[model samples]
Target: MSLSSFKREFARHYNDTPANYIKTKRLEKAAELLLISDERIKDIAFNCGYNDLANFTKSFRERYSCTPSDFRER
Candidate 1:
């Protein structure tokens, strides 16, 4: 199958583009780590595949309405 065909099928099955799916998974994992561990927010962001803490925090806030550290504190 062509790349387009595969991507379309994936979207139809998952209701999300691959990039969105990946970002969602990464954020979910980061939230899980925050609840389960005492690791620093930046470290958790890095472990969740983010290289820059600001971008990670931005994305986290967009998804959850709070920064990673604030999310963890609550």
Candidate 2:
């Protein structure tokens, strides 16, 4: 089967596309890490599969309505 077929089956099984699911899960993990540790935001972004700090910050803000540092501060 092709990658598209797998993606379709994955969506049918999980009710979310793989890309969205991955992004959601990564942010969730980042949130958890922020709450549980004293790691820097850049490190957390790297751990969450985000290599670019700016992109990670933008994505995090979009998902959580706050930057990683702000979320950690709360």
Candidate 3:
């Protein structure tokens, strides 16, 4: 099947929007990277498809209520 069909099927199965599905996956991966790697914040942002560090920081803070560094520290 096509990507769109697969996304639709997955969303139906999970009862979530495709965008939300992708965001959840990205956040999970970001948490893993933060806990397991010493990589730079900017590198993690870019690797997670965020081109702007500020935007990435905003999103990260919104989700975790803290900056990436602070999250890592805890």
Task: Tell me the TM-score of model 3.
Answer: 0.78
Which window of 10 residues has the lowest lDDT sum in candidate 2?
A: 37-46
| Candidate 2 residue-wise lDDT, 1-74, digit = tens | 99999999999999999999999999999999999999888899999999999999999999999998999999
Rate residue 64 of model 1 by lDDT. 96
lDDT by residue (1-74, candidate 3, tens digit) is 99999888988899987887777788768877998999998899889988898988888888889999898899
For 1-74, candidate 1 gives per-residue lDDT tens digits of 99999889999999999899999999999999999999998899999999999999999999999888888898
Error of 2 at 28 (Å): 0.6
Residue-pair clashes per candidate = 0, 0, 0
Ranking by TM-score: 1, 2, 3
* lDDT score for residue 19 of model 2: 97
For all candidates in order, the CA lDDT equals 0.94, 0.95, 0.86
RMSDs, each prediction?
Answer: 0.7, 0.9, 2.3
User: What range of 10 consecutive residues in model 1 has the weakest lDDT sum?
Assistant: 65-74
Clashing pairs in 2: none
